[model samples]
Target: MTDTTTTAPAHGVTISEAAADKVHRLLVQEGRDDLRLRVAVQPGGCSGLIYQLYFDERVLDGDAVVEFPAADGATVEVVVDRMSVPYLDDSKIDFEDSIEKQGFTIDNPNAQGSCACGDSFS
Candidate 1:
């Protein structure tokens, strides 16, 4: 961990645990190794920018990787950068398994508003 980077506590964010577990399970099912869940912000959502999450294998310099214990007792890591921290820091990621919806949703405290389509954020 870097000076400015820290991991979330076990009783911290709610969504993070589920997201980490889902990511871990996905990697395992896909037969992947050494992959990290990369979350970032890029311009072009309904708002000014949208959240981006994906499995990444490459680790860049200055990247902040947050490690959390999964439900299965494995450590899951999410890598972000200095720039994307403010938008994603302290944010919770959860999986929606309802019949009407099934995907990862972000609960970001920094987000002011999101687009109608749910692709962009203010």
Candidate 2:
């Protein structure tokens, strides 16, 4: 498969166009124009580390931000907390809508192994 990630060396994470489009639609559905997609790594999963993805309005201290231009002419901002940076570095967030699954997926190069459910990484 072709690489859809647009990784900026200065930034910790990247978002695919499909992911950006999905996020934009969700934001619009929630009527939250001021919110951003916050990605973080939290301790505790079947593996070792778990990924956390949510909509956040507050920009915490030392948060790394990256902007992606959506097909709708609007920009989507993705934020990652300082602590999660190392775990998510060079990671790509993608969206898939196949008959089997329909959701956001993370491609993390830093992960050595992941759980059977694919929710946690070691």
Q: What lDDT tens digits, residue by residue, belong to model 2 across residues 42-120?
A: 9889998899999999887777777887767987889887788888888999999999999999999999999999999
RMSD of each: 3.3, 5.3
Please write out the lDDT profile of model 1 over residues 25-66, one tens digit for every residue: 898899886887787889885689988889898768767766
Worst 10 residues of 1 by lDDT: 3-12
Residue pairs in candidate 1 whose N, alpha carbon or C atoms collide under 3 angstroms? 15-93, 45-120, 46-120
Error of 2 at 95 (Å): 0.2
Off by over 4 Å in 2: 1-9
